[model samples]
Target: MYDTILVPTDGSTVAEHAVDHAIDLAETYDATVHALYVVDTSAVDIGLGTEQVDRIRQGKFGDMPELEQRARDATGAVATKAADCGLDVTEAVVGGQPHGQIADYADDHDVDLIVMGSAGRSGVRRALLGSVAERTLRTTRRPVLVVDAETGTGSD
Candidate 1:
């Protein structure tokens, strides 16, 4: 039923599981898998102070180039996993609000499905912090399969 499947990875173990599941699905359905890694600007903004933001603006975080490189590496890893499953795969990295970027990418690429991982935070925690998968599910028009990190179960 799916022609193009978009899988967003955050380099987390849960996201890795999601990618694995997406690869299997792609192989079964003969769908093309588009893997995305979003360098969540929000996370960086929260973790780093204003001084760090200024340094980033001045292009001075050379020591942290590995951070961006790691995201690319995660994308490559997911692409490789999909390819190994004999599925067509493409990968990219974007920087922005993770959920917005993912949703916009799905629309821009005409993705039929989105498979993502949830850290499984709930109630007050989820309300206060929010979740990229939850936000994407709420905003996107396409079908979304949210995989729980702990159980690895999804709406599929």
Candidate 2:
């Protein structure tokens, strides 16, 4: 039933796990796979979380070339894997709040399904970091398949 499946990757192992799921589903449905990597401009003020992400966001452009490249690399990795499997693939990099951007992309593209990963945090960690997958699930009306890092082949 799925004709378009969206996978949002942050280049983490958890996201890679989600990519695996997306690829399998796309193969089964013979659907197009859309790989999205959000820059999460919101994190810019807070130092961008990771070292690589921080370095990229600090570049010259309003949304730096480095930042876009990182986003592309993340999406490109997914695209490459999907394309290698003979699946139709589309890739995009955008700067915004991650959850909002994901929801918007899904709605704008009329995606049938969204497969994503969550770090499954709790108590203080969950409270501070927040879960993009959880926020995305709350915002979007579309179907979402969440692969939990804590329970899956990924570290929280």
Best by lDDT: 2
Off by over 4 Å in 2: 45-63, 153-156
Clash pairs of candidate 1? none
Q: What tens digits encode model 1's per-residue C-alpha lDDT throughout 1-156?
A: 988999999778989878877877888889999988876665677778777655544334555788768877888898888887788888877766778888989999999999999898979998898888889988889889988899888874
Measured on C-alpha atoms, candidate 1 has an lDDT of: 0.83
Question: TM-score of each candidate?
Answer: 0.85, 0.84
- lDDT at position 1, candidate 1: 91
lDDT of 2 by residue, 32-148 (tens): 999988777666646445654544433323445676677778889999999999999998876668899899999999999999998778999988888999899889999999987
Q: What lDDT does the true structure give each of the candidates? A: 0.83, 0.83
Provide the clashing-pair count of each candidate structure.
0, 0
Range of the 10 consecutive residues with the lowest summed lDDT in candidate 2: 54-63
